[model samples]
Target chain A: MARLSYLKALQRALIDEMSRDESVFVLGEDIRVGVNNVTTGLLAKFGPQRVLDTPLSEQGFTSFATGAALAGMRPVIEFQIPSLLFLVFEQIANQAHKFSLMTGGQARVPVTYFVPGSGSKTGWAGQHSDHPYGLFAHVGVKTVVPATPADAYGLFVSAIREDDPVVIFAPAGSLGVRDDVDLETLSAVPLGVGTIHRPGSDVTVVAVGHHVQTALAVADQLEGEISVEVWDPRSLYPFDWSGLAESVNRTGRLVVIDDSNRHCGIAGEILATAAEQMRLTAPPRRVTRPSGAVLPFALALDLACQPDAEQLVTAVREVAKD
Target chain B: MEASLYRMVRLIRRFEERCVELVRSGDIIGGIHPYIGQEAIAAGVCAALRFDDIITSTHRGHGHVLAKGADPIRMLAELCGKVTGLNRGRGGSMHAADFSKGIFGANGIVGAGGAIATGAAWAFLRQGGGDKVAVSFFGDGAVSQGVLLEAMNLAALWKVPVLFVCENNGYATTLTVSESVAGTICGRASAFGIPSSTVDGMDAAVVFEAASAAVESARRGEGPAFLECLTYRFDAHHTWEHKARVRYRPAEEEVSGRLRDPVEIAGGRLDPAERESIDEAIEALLDEAVAFATTSPAPDPSTALDYLYGSAVLP
Candidate 1:
């Protein structure tokens, strides 16, 4: 089996999809030069027409992708920064997402908004660092945060094929992670399906995006005492709620580790859903960033606010004890 | 040509008036943005367009949609939130659309449709299906929006076949175009090398002539064109304004605004007997349309989210 990095898997998915469907085109700033390496060789392989290089106007190009989609072209837009989503939120939320319902199902805006390295990156602070999958998920936009290389390849392909506007956030942490996998075996992962990374009975630690790997590693380290079930709800919007109920029903305990802000984030939504309807032996715990968190420029301050593996270890142990 | 144009304008006028009545009767839940005085722009612009040509409309877009050939009965039913409505009642009033007729949608956000039209033009340019053009209808208030300006730059740069029709109807909500928009509206388009002109939106023939020239240029791969249609809104911006009684402009503005009515201008171009016959036919059509919409059943509460996504799955 050949080893492929999460970043390479994403690039391969783009290359494969463009080859299979000529309607699949990309629009973004500096994507011709492949700034973040996700669009690394797309321009050369597919030419400029398929690999569209856009201007710095986020609002313009974002709605532009929607227009293209309405005219029978599937557009895949690349946002260089995560916070850029804030600038074009109206284009996605109001214009593109609303078309289907607004047009009485007469229109379909099948555009994929890909954020190459979302959330905090080493020393980048404030505006550059935000994992806003929660924002899209909350607004009913199909959101995917792939936890592994295979998942990245599969989910990206599925998102492009969906008949609605989809947002794929490639976290800053998972981009470099590599795995041993066969390219021929790569296929679309079903949306709204949760994947359990490791099997356990003591506590279910539901992690999203990059934290799936973190939860898996912590489960291995704490194998002697606490048995942790690491679950990743890959598609966050339709949110494998049934799968989550089954998992919580078995473990009878829940803990969510999400990178978004503590207040009104995906973590809060998951806990509320579980408390209201799902089976739970104890009060579910959530490990997340501080309220209204803004990552600082200094490395130390940034790490302090972010939910680390140490925090996950503590939360998992505390939940298991109860 | 004169009779058909007059018929459309009359149909729009009656449809909008009926919609206002529906709002008052509580049949239409949310009050609508009336297209009372700007009927000439929609009639003229759509008259110059082919059936396949696409258009993106503004919040005040019922006239554009109706002119582009949507069924008035279904459109009215949509406003009434009936299952038989054009958008199956999901789009409501502001977002009503019929893609089969190339009506993209009536956008709630100002100036957002220009960029979508630009992108649609790019697709048409790539397809090259013998002169398919896209149009965007916005107000003078949208001239200052960064996205619309950026779309003009992209359309000019790529030579996309798009016609930017700015319906300069004097006021966006309560603020006059002069107070909100800086500089002239045509200046914004010419800065990006797009050929532009300002026409009398009150006269249907004048607007049709301007649109024909712009549409011809666009279809021949000459990039985008801009037309600033000088018009006025004779009624309240929203139906709610009738009760709110907000008076931002002088009373004379309303009195003078009706002097050059588009309906009268187009109707005058026709023989008096032919105009009267068309008027009679339109009233009959609208009477049936109102009956069909009023009799249609309202959507069930359980199916409130049926059309949120085109595909079936959890929201």
Candidate 2:
């Protein structure tokens, strides 16, 4: 069995889709050289036509992908920096994402916005560091933040195959994650589906993106003390609310761990939804970056802004008391 | 060719006049950005292309949509927000589109559609065809938009067939090209090494000749071409300006600009009878379109959220 890294898994997914369908292609800045190694070997394998190197214009290429998708081609756009999503927010959220509905379903922009190295990367600083997946999910773009190697491969492949536009955020932290599995068994994971890393009876800890890995580690540390169910909602926009309900129904207590802002973050929504629809014994708690949280230049302060395992453990401990 | 151009400009002229009436009557919810002055540009540019060729329009896009062979009745219905509209009323005046007719859309965003046209042209080139050319119709205001400039670079690099038509109708709403645009519109294209031209946009014949040459070059795989059409807007930017009383362009400029009317220029090419027949035909067509639109039923509010997603199940 070979160990497949998350970045390699994403690369494989793109290669497989490009090979399977001729209309599928990748376009972005420096993808010809495969910046950050996400698009490595794609230019040589698929050639320059299929693998295009666009100018620094994020809005132009993003809308170009939408236009290409309108003309019967599937384009997968790679953004090296996460903040580029902010610059092209209108291009994605307003233009491509709204194309289908705006055109009365006549236009289906099957463009994939692949953002590798999302969130903080130590000294990347304020301009470069951002996880705007919550904004897309809020505006109803099919958003996915895969937490592992296998999930990255499966969700990315599925996003390209989808008829609508999808934004895939491959977190910088989880890029090194590896899964020991047979290459043939790696398959497509449908959107709006959630996965349980560890089933527990006491509390349901809903995690997103790379936070699932932390939730699992915390679950491991609290094994004898508390049985925690680590729930990873692979697709955020078309959120797996039903799958979440099933788990919260079993545990009767919930705690959401997310890297987004506290105000209107995924964690806040998870807690609110669990309270509204699911059976919960105690007031559901949430661990998130403070409202309007900006990651500072210093490493220590940057790490402080992101939700950590320590806060999750304390939230879990507090919720378990009820 | 002259008769068809005359007919199109006349049809657009009357269609816009009726649209203004509908706006005043409150039949149309949002007042429209009337394409009253720029009829010749749309008439000539569309006439130079094939039916399969695509065009992306701006907010003042009724003339382009009509010239590209969109059903007037359905387009009017769209402005009325009816189910039978082109986009089924989801996209209103600024976003009216008919994919079947190759009118990608009338976008609200100033220069956003340029890149979309470039992408379509890129796709067509990738498919190894010379028959198709994508046209992006914008304004003098869009000349400086970063995305439009980026799109030109891509189109030039890929040698894709894209015709960038800039209707330099003096004002980008209230701001004049002199006030906002610093450099020459043609100079911007020339810097990209793309072949460009400046034509009298008020005359259909001049616009047709310029557009025809550019379209021919694009079809020959000569990359993208730019056309800066120096025309004038005969109406307010939006019908809302009627009540808001925003005075931007001078009354003298309007008086002098109306001297070279697109309708009179195109109509002058034909005999008196031909001009009268074209005018009568357009009036009847617009009357029918107005009747069709006014009678069309609005879509149900309950289904407002329908088609928000193309997935099997809505989230």
Candidate 3:
């Protein structure tokens, strides 16, 4: 058994994919130097041609990746800061995402946009702190937010291999979490699938990215009083609705813990779908950031804005009572 | 040399004139950004490119698409939103593309095509293909976009074989180049240490000579080259002006701008009989193009999302 950190899992996924397929290349600002450590040693192994260090031109390079993908190369772009996604929204959303439909099926932009430090890093205020996985999901781009090291490796590998454009947001909170796993057992996890960490009968706790750990811990703390099922959806868009329905069917109640804003966030979508289609005995609840949240620089303010274990526990208890 | 360049200019001129008539007769919807005055740049630059080379065009793109060997009838059908169009009615006016003929696409966004051309060139090189070159054509307005600057840096850094052609027609939708851009246009490329030159865009021969040298350098793997074609627009930005009445350029200025029409300049090179024959041939082509476009069927609403994804449906 080996303990793999989330960051190391990302690095291993990149190395494995690049070694497995020559068409898989990494491009971003300061990637050759491995500024984020997710691309460590990749430059030395793949060389400059495969591990390209692009200029700080987010729009240009984003579209550059789209073009490369269309021309039969799979490009993985690393964003140092999450806010840079806003700058290249047009490139990814309007250009790359639309290429398949706009070109009469002549093109496939198999580009993977990897954001290593998404969400809040304490003291990194307004500009640096953003979790925009919800935006990608809204635009129907395959969006993934991995919670554990093993899932990180599996989802990233799947995103790279996917024929459509995929956005993998490696949350800052989950980057440090390590998982003890068998090295020989590491394998590709299919997208749009949910993993149940703990099966229970009272309530199903749907968690996203970093919140999965909180849900599991809360479930452990409330062991005998409530039977909690922790469900981690590795991929956000084309979400594992069937898997979620099965979990909810067993538990009969639902609570979604997410680090995004309340309005139009992934949590809202989960609750809405469960209410509309899924079999739920009681009304579902969601713990999320305030609507239109802008995380402040102070540690306390940042913590206050994000969905925490306390909120998850409270929401779980509320859903249980329902 | 001048006569051949003039012939291309005449061809583009008549081609666009027929396209404008198609717009009026409701054959081509969503009126085009007519390339009426800036014909010399497309004519001259495309004249230098081989059939195997590729070009990525812009919104005012019919000239480059046509000059790069797209069939006139198919292109007109595209503008008409017909099923027989280049992209089968999916692209409409702003997104006509014919990859087989080496026209990657005519993008609607400003300054967005440079990196696409660079990436395509990189792919060509990586595949061990011949030293095929790519040309990205944009306007003076595109010079201010940071993405274009980034693309220039990437092209220079990777030593990709591409030619960045900037057609400086002054206005980026009503704003003059002097009012919008801070530094010189060619300076943007020169800043990346890529060899850049400014040529007389109104003269087809000069543009052809400059583009030929740049294209040859790129084919030899000498990295990217940038050419600033100094020209002016002889028509409004869009045909909507025929009804909207948005005035930007002075009336006298417009008259002076159209004075050295590239068609007349290039037409001067051919013998009178040769010029007459070319004119007759172009007219006939335009007639057939208009007829075909007018008769072509519009795309069905049921299959609008036919190309939404490349992969087979997930079972």
Candidate 4:
């Protein structure tokens, strides 16, 4: 057993996958020097052929990865800032994501778009702070957000092995998390599967990415008074609907804590699905950032724009009441 | 060599004309951007390439798809949206692909395939693909797109074996190249230190000569090269323009542009009897293609979302 940080778990996954598959390679800006520390030793370990330092052309490299994938290479692109995803949105969502269906299954792009420190990092401000996994999920690109160190390792492995284009967001809020785990136990965690962090009988809280930590905290605080169940949906797109239904059925109430802004966000989908398919005692509720939220520079303002434990607590209480 | 080039140009011209007819008759649902006058470019460039060499194409891609040796019957079926088509009707006109033939895809987005082709070139070499080159076919309008230019820079930087072919067909959907492009099309590659040349796009032999030199240089590990094939569009930018009557080209320019017809330019090199036989052969082949395209059954609507992911069970 060893104590591993969430960022280190991601790094370990990259090393393991690259060692396992000759086709696997990585490219990004400043990745050679490990600007984000997720690719610290990859350059020396994998060499320049596998570890490429691309110019600051997000659109170019993103589509380049697509072409390489078409030529039978598994490329993992590391985006230093989460919002750089917007610059390559067309390449990933419009181009790579559509290739499989557009080509009638003649091609499969096994590229992993790895965005470390996704979502609000205290004072990064507007351009660097946005979390857009919801956009990829809406476009039907495979999307995953692992909240634990073990899950970070497992899901990153699975994302690299996935035959389709996948966007794996490692939330900034969870980057500092560390857990004591057996190294041998870490393996590929299949996509589209959700895990129950804390089982309860009253309200099921669907927490996304790093918000799983906050939901767990909120559930602990409401322990005796309200039975709050925390469900972490590691893979967002191929969501474990049946798993969500089972939890919602047992608890009889649902509340979602999502990092995305309200309008057309995954939170709204969760609420709608629960309301439509599950037996809920009260109307399902969600705690999300305001619609069109642009995180302000000040620490307090940044904290204000993010979904917090307090909001999740309130949501769970409201949903459990009826 | 001349006869083969003439045959390609004739095939593309007739195929596109047949597609336009199908569009008018409601057999083909959406309109296609006809590759009428730009046939010499696809034919010339593809003639210089081996069957294993890869090529990425643009929205005006039928000529490239046909020149790269995709089955005309399957391609026509694809345009007609039949289950028996190249992409099984999943990709209609703009998105057809045949990986087995090294035809990566005919991208729907403008300027998108350049970077993709460059990356493929880089990987082909890295994966020990000896002397194999990739060709990216885009229009004059794509020269200004940042991604395509960025691709040129990277291709030159890494010495990736890729050929950038710019088909200068005068208009980018009603906007003239003069109105849109600020600099010479070849200058875009020159800025990236990639050797480039401008050729007559209407003369198949001239284009073939330029493309052959560039493809050979790239294959020799001299890095990437570029070719700007100056041509004209003899048909509407898209079949939709027929009804819209968006008159962007002057009547005199239109008449003058048709004078240097690629088909006639290539056919002039052939004997009268040989030209007539080639034309007859093309018409019979196209007749079979059209019959196959129109008679093939439509894909089941229930399987509309079948190939969305690599694993059919992902969703």
For all the predictions, what are the DockQ values? 0.78, 0.77, 0.54, 0.79
Q: Summarize candidate 1's per-residue lDDT along B202-264 as a digit string, tens digits.
A: 988888889999999988888899999999998889999999999998988788988999989
Best candidate according to lDDT: 4
lDDT, candidates in the order shown: 0.90, 0.91, 0.88, 0.93
Q: Look at candidate 3 and give me any clashing residue pairs.
A: B6-B266
Predicted candidate 4 versus true structure: per-residue lDDT over B89-178, tens digit per residue: 999999988998999999989999999999999999989947899999999889878999889888999999999999998888888898
Angstrom error of the Cα, residue B73, model 2: value is 0.9
DockQ of 3: 0.54
Task: Give one clash count per candidate, in the order shown.
Answer: 0, 0, 1, 0
i-RMS for every candidate (Å) is 1.2, 1.1, 2.1, 1.1
Task: Give the least accurate 10-residue stretch of model 2 chain A, judged by summed lDDT.
Answer: A97-106
Candidate 3: tens digits of C-alpha lDDT, residues A17-136: 999999999999999889899887887888888998877788888988877786789999999999999999988888888877766665688999999989998899999999999998
- Residues B1-315 of candidate 3: C-alpha lDDT, one tens digit per residue: 666676668777887888788778877778989999899999899999988888888999988988888898898888888888888889966788887888888888998889888887888788775988899999999999888788889889889999999999889999999999988998888799999999999988889999999999999999999999988888779989987999989889888888988887778777889889888888898889888988989889999778776653221
Q: Say which prediction, candidate 1 or candidate 2, comes out ahead on DockQ.
A: 1
Q: Considering summed lDDT, which 10 consecutive residues are worst modelled in model 2 chain B?
A: B306-315
Residues A42-136, candidate 4: write the lDDT tens digits. Answer: 99998999999999899999999999999999999999999899999999999999999988899999999999999988889999998898899
Error of 2 at A237 (Å): 0.9
DockQ winner among the candidates? 4
TM-score (chain A) of candidate 4?
0.99
